[model samples]
Target: MPTLAHQQIHPHPHNKSAFAKHVILLLSTMMAGVLQASSATDQHYPIDVQSCDRIVTFDHAPKATVSNDVNLTEMMLALKLQDSMVGFTGVSGWKTLDPTLRNGIGELPELSPKYPSKEVLLGADADFYFAGWNYGMRVGGGVTPDTLDPLGIKVYELTESCIHIMDKPKVSMNDLYNDLLNLGRIFNVESRANTLVTGYKKELADFQAHLTPLPSPTKVFVYDSGEEQPFTSGRYGMPTALIEAAGGKNITDDVKKSWTQIGWESVIDRAPDVIIIVNYGDVTAQQKINFLRSNPAFSDIPAVKNNQFTVLEYVEATPGPRNIEAIKHLAKAFRAAL
Candidate 1:
């Protein structure tokens, strides 16, 4: 019941319906004794609960449009519910949206890039707010779910960003699938969700069958997110799968955890065949490449010598429905080098 905005504003959206329901039932049974001792009105607190108590629930799901980013919005479209959206932000130039959805996405006002003033966000009269994560809305900065809560607006965080309650124990293609399933249920589109999941699995299976086993997989390094210290994904993260699917060995596979600090000496010792840098909002791929080429330590590596460097959009690297496409693109890039 703590009202700290950031505690719930996790990087990923999470789903805790099953666990929450069980706990609620157990707690309500125990609290029955305490409630019986108090006034009858006190007993009503446990009876009127909605599944997710952190945010308020509406009597009817409202027309919503997501403003934070594309992955969540695209998944909704895949569910055939793009029409449910009324507005979005930071997507005027999006090329991947279906033509129909593009028009819809375009019509919606942009509330992001920078968080909209409290008045701007509320003025949309949105019933539900969908966000990729919480960074866009933090306390003492811009309006957050808490800001909208008092006004009776609801917010649903994308399940992929929910680090605490992800349906998959870890972030992976499996986690994205789980989120798609949950979104289908949320929007009453189970059959469509099932169809999309089936199609994606079949496509991936077919693609995997065609890949010849790696005869001599060379060590490859993914240098994502940082220039000075270098932030890279370790063995357990999405980058591991990306490296393997592309038929290359990940040099960072021995390290554990999602993101970690790595020393320049490790890169020198491993001597990766290829290096990939992820590009996002402010930094371009060219900037990362320029940084590495000028660095004293990496300039001598074989990867740098051969210019076996590549860059990918940050969204494609994230664990979501688009990951298979990312893997295929990486595989193509790696295979071309051979």
Candidate 2:
């Protein structure tokens, strides 16, 4: 037997060919792995998402986008999909976000303080728009799904705002979860979405279990806006569901719409035991309270007289992950008021 060094240095002709074949086999195996990884990254294409009457198909995940309002923007950030976002707007309740979320959001570009104009949205060259009813695109604003779809852009509306168009009987947490799962499917993050939904469900169940139900549901009124005529959440809105889930009754439950403006007399006649003021826009919650306290019309109201008021941020009242927290907060307030 020859020494091992001599055999490798002075290999036979046949041995040389065999060594080359082995090298080629190794390279081929490595190439196959690279291809497999590329395929995995390309999976979940041609996904169809149903938004009300429209079935929008996404050939690939949106790379650039314009997201509107705190609700949709926060949802995208919670999914850890900030790279997909190009610009965002509507920062009404952004201060209430967790520090981590706030830091993540701070890195993104703020396209506008409010809803972006169609020109601004188009200028961003975004492929998708995440928004809600009247929060972003408005009728005749020239940025709707009909207008954007023709330009190769897709739009997804918040499910809570689509009850009227989708014929949903009432708002539920399922709507928020469905939207999260749908976005996950669209973005190929089903596992993350499932985990988030599971966590929220567990937390909500725990909150409900510990809640002490009132002898009678507290008659609650949701004050959103409109000083001339009070604008409140109706039976179809997320606020109504939150109120009911928190062991309180929404006085506007009879109104079959989302948010409606009713005369002051209706609110007076209803005589809500507790008032939930929505904090948003130019009108502060303190201003609303002052208005209620100073006005002779509201003097007779039990909530105003007894000072049973709970203030919820505009984002909390919307359909999002925060809704569960809103329920817990309201439930605590209801228990305290009793």
Q: What C-alpha RMSD separates each model from the true structure?
A: 16.3, 6.1
Please write out the lDDT profile of model 2 over residues 1-338, one tens digit for every residue. 88864675555787998888886998999999999877876776777898866788888889987788877888897788898988887664333444554686777877877677667777889888998677686756766888788777789887877754557757778888988988898777889999999999999999899878799999999998888999999988889989988999999998888878888898899999999999977788999999999999899999999999999988789877788899999999888887
* Model 1, span 133-248: residue lDDT tens: 43244434456666777776667655444542222344456656766775655555558889999998888888878976666775788887576577887765666777776678
Candidates' C-alpha lDDT:
0.64, 0.83
Per-structure clash totals for the candidates? 5, 0
**If scored against the real structure, what TM-score would every candidate get?**
0.68, 0.87
Error of 2 at 70 (Å): 0.8
Output the TM-score of candidate 2: 0.87
Per-residue error for 257 in candidate 1, Å, reads 5.3
Candidate 1 segments whose C-alpha is farther than 4 A from its true place: 1-59, 90-104, 115-120, 134-150, 164-168, 216-218, 234-237, 253-263
